[model samples]
Target: MLINKSFANQAGVSLIEILVTTLILGVGLLGVAALQISSLSSNQEGLFASQATAIAEDYASRVRSSKTSTVMPNTNISYAQFVAAYHNGNNAPLACAAAPAQLCRSDAGNAALDCTLAQLAIYDQWEVCSAAQEALPGGLVRVLNNGIRLTIVVDWDSEQGREDIGNVAVRNNNCSPLTGSNTRNCVILELVP
Candidate 1:
């Protein structure tokens, strides 16, 4: 039986066709991998923002609770004074143990070494700042007051440069600490008492 020459030559895919097919598949896989990486980075950024929001909320609640009484018991110092104690900027945590003892009771071990209302405010700031630093990369906290309002600014390093979402600029001069670095992200929350 004689095989048709043309049919035999075209029976299977050529070597060049196989190589081209493999190259296309490899490029497609690489694109998928790039997309996966971008997705993971975005997820991480969202998580950090969520954490910052929660931290700011927690501190705001504490401040609100303190505003219940106009003046601290047994002291002329007012609620505004208490709020002012939290206006710290990247300062080292206050030494709670070194602070003067007062009526404000703490935990079991340090029940005797109680804190004053002002001391309590400082301690609260320290706790919030520590939380921010631990939960984020290069984290920092700034408590700012402009007489009528209180602002909590939580800053962290994004590793990669700024990510502009929805064509909105992430780095704004109004953000204070965030304006310095393109790689830094911040959550600013304002509370009015």
Candidate 2:
């Protein structure tokens, strides 16, 4: 029996076509995997930024509410004193573990032991700074008062391999960079309170 010439040629062409298709599919799948990895990295960066913003906003809100007469003394404690208490030299926050016993109370039993304005301010700073440290890797806080505006700066270490040097430089303009590393992320919030 003689095999048809057309049948032999068609069989060889089909095998070649399948091999080519598989190679293309493999390349496409690899591209998709890379895209997935990049997306996850971007999401993580966004989460860090969101956390920073929340921390700054929360502290600002605390300051705003602290302006009421109930929170501050009528004559002894000025708003300036409250603001001054938060001035950290761009360093890690003082440990809240040493916070005054009155400041840590959750029950009405401590209502008579009202925290002084200075102690309240310190407590607020500790609360915010501790949150930043816990939420972000290598996180830090700095409060700066330039006689006119108050600035709250929160910074943290950027994830490894995600450092865009140009972006880091731009983001850190108002805040100090992390020690020995240019790869840091920061958020700055300026407030009058």
Candidate 3:
């Protein structure tokens, strides 16, 4: 009778053990969830970075293929104009194997103009200027006579109603960075000719 009574008494888990197990399981689950969230956020951020890089490169290529004089300092190539010019092949003489305008054609050679200064490499954002307010993304220019440096900047937040995408210089050699998430991806391109 005593043995049977003792066995019954110890048949189940102790309250402290159960509590510890519950606490451990809860903590582990929370950690896993935090990890998942962080991973997902990182993935999204990577995608954004990729897109920014693509935009920057596209901008660089467009500038490369187009006539440099058209986009020189004090010129007024609006954002729309820039995009249109990029898509339209920049009036470059199409090669024999030229594809349609909608397709991104390659300009392996045949010559192209280089960028000028105000083309700083630091403050990397696209800007355009208007008569009333020059807060656009195309007013910045670099003045380089012997050599030219180019940086392609992407404006991911501009289309989303953000206010921090329009004040980068062409060279950006000396500028302070803003205190927030990065607003641009600057690819440095240099030309000497």
**RMSD list, candidates in order:** 5.5, 5.0, 13.3
- lDDT leaderboard ranking: 2, 1, 3
* Lowest summed lDDT window (length 10), candidate 2: 165-174
TM-score of each model, in listed order:
0.74, 0.75, 0.42
Q: Pick the candidate with the highest TM-score.
A: 2
Q: Residue 191 error for model 2, in Å?
A: 0.5
Residue range 39-106, candidate 3, lDDT tens digits: 65555445544544454454454455443444444466643454333322222211223222221222
Model 2 residue 132 CA deviation in Å: 1.0
Q: What is the model-wide C-alpha lDDT for candidate 1?
A: 0.67
Q: Which segments of model 2 are wrong by more than 4 Å?
A: 1-8, 12-14, 70-73, 89-101, 104-112, 160-181
| Per-residue error (Å), model 2, residue 45 | 0.7
Quantify all predictions' global Cα lDDT against the true fold: 0.67, 0.68, 0.36
* lDDT (Cα, tens digit) per residue for candidate 2, span 141-176: 667776656787777777542554223322444354
lDDT of 1 by residue, 1-193 (tens): 9999889878688899999999999999999988986776677778888998998898898777666543445477755676676665343322333433343436467563445567667666666777877787767676777777877777777763234322222454555443366656788899885
lDDT of 3 at 29: 100
**Shift in Å, residue 127, candidate 3:** 13
